[model samples]
Target: MILTDTHTHLYSEAFDKDRDEVIRRAVDNGIERFFIPAIDSTYTQAMMDLESDYPENIFLMAGLHPTHVKEDYKRELKHVEQQLKERKFHAVGEIGIDLYWDKTFLRQQQEAFRLQIQWAKEYRLPIVIHCRESFDEIIEILESEKGDDLFGIFHCFTGNLEQAKTAISYNMKLGIGGVVTFKNGKIDGFLDQIDLRHIVLETDSPYLAPVPYRGKRNESAYLINVLEKLSDVYGRSKEDIAKITTENSKEVFGV
Candidate 1:
């Protein structure tokens, strides 16, 4: 049972107190891979430190998050670019248009998203997107930029079947997480209809914790809650779900 958490901020300040213990618990629970997404340059050092400590288990990504976009976005984008050129990262992500927080930087967010996608293509790496309350907008951008060079995961996907199909058409895999266990999450109703190959598991830790741990701080160990829920949704054994999703993640991150 080699579970892969494709999106988790193991480097988040939320785990500052006992990050190592939290990681050990996840490892004990069979989580072997942890993909860390960048929010901005602010957490860069922490993420680097995390990878340094767990070189085999941790993989890093470089990008400017949508909500983190502001008047100084260009500078941040430059920093992402410089980092990508300087070293290897698994992907260019958790990047996309986020309208849930503030629409003030919508234009900047779109521009940044497109530019990051181009950067991902340039580096021959997959992207990890953070689509929140702007599916239509993100779809429009992906539609325009669609090509052989573009592909990645729609991190923390919580959309409908049609949207899932649309994302797949653009070479994006659906990233399922704790949301699938939510009573009103809605995706659970149609998840089984989607192929497991198009799905990857995640926890989006420190957020979106599954039931039983709902509203509490989420850790990678809680991924078992999601894996259990998915076992029911897909009508497969927990070990099967873990194996298939881990394979799917390798297809995305190439690790």
Candidate 2:
């Protein structure tokens, strides 16, 4: 089974002690391809270091995360643009509206999201969105930006069937993660209704760990737990789920 963790922050400081071991464990368990998302300018060097260490396994993206948007957002966006212009990236993402942590920068967040989406289209690269408590707001922006040129994965999707259909209408593949294994995670109820082609697997490591490790820090190896839950939800074999989701990820990341 070739599992693709389409969204993971393997460069996070949480794995400073054993990042290599964590990666090795995931790879050993068949989580082969990792699509790394950008948070902001601060983590760029760390992300680059990880890719240099594992060139064959890591695919990097460039963008400023919504939660990270602040008074100096234009500077952050400039960094994102500069990075994208300087090198090749699989996508322009982990970008979108995240009003969960704070709403003070909502306008800045929307602006950052719009600019990044345009950058992705300009580069002909896919985008990975990070929507938190602002689904409606994000959808609103996406509605205006919808077109054949604007399409990517909605990372860590936890919306209803209607919202899922809406996201798909904009050509996005829903990124399912550890939350699908939680008892309160409602996505499990209607995930089967969403076609396998419109789904992609992600770990979102260091956050949203699956059932057994629910409150603990997540790691890429735990993606297997998510794969198992998805198998149960779709009534498909784990191997089959992994294969299809990996393909879905490839379609989004072009890797």
Question: In lDDT terms, which candidate is top?
Answer: 1
lDDT by residue (55-173, candidate 1, tens digit) is 99999999999999999999999999999999999999999999998999999999999999999999999999999999999999999999999999999999999999999999999
* Clashing residue pairs in candidate 2 (N, C-alpha, C atoms within 3 angstroms): none
Q: Ten residues in a row with the worst lDDT in model 1?
A: 4-13
How big is the positional error of residue 50 in model 2, measured in Å on the Cα after superposition?
A: 0.3
- Once fitted onto the true fold, the runs of candidate 2 whose alpha carbons sit more than 4 angstroms away are none
Model 1 per-residue lDDT at 144? 91
Each candidate's number of clashing pairs is 0, 0
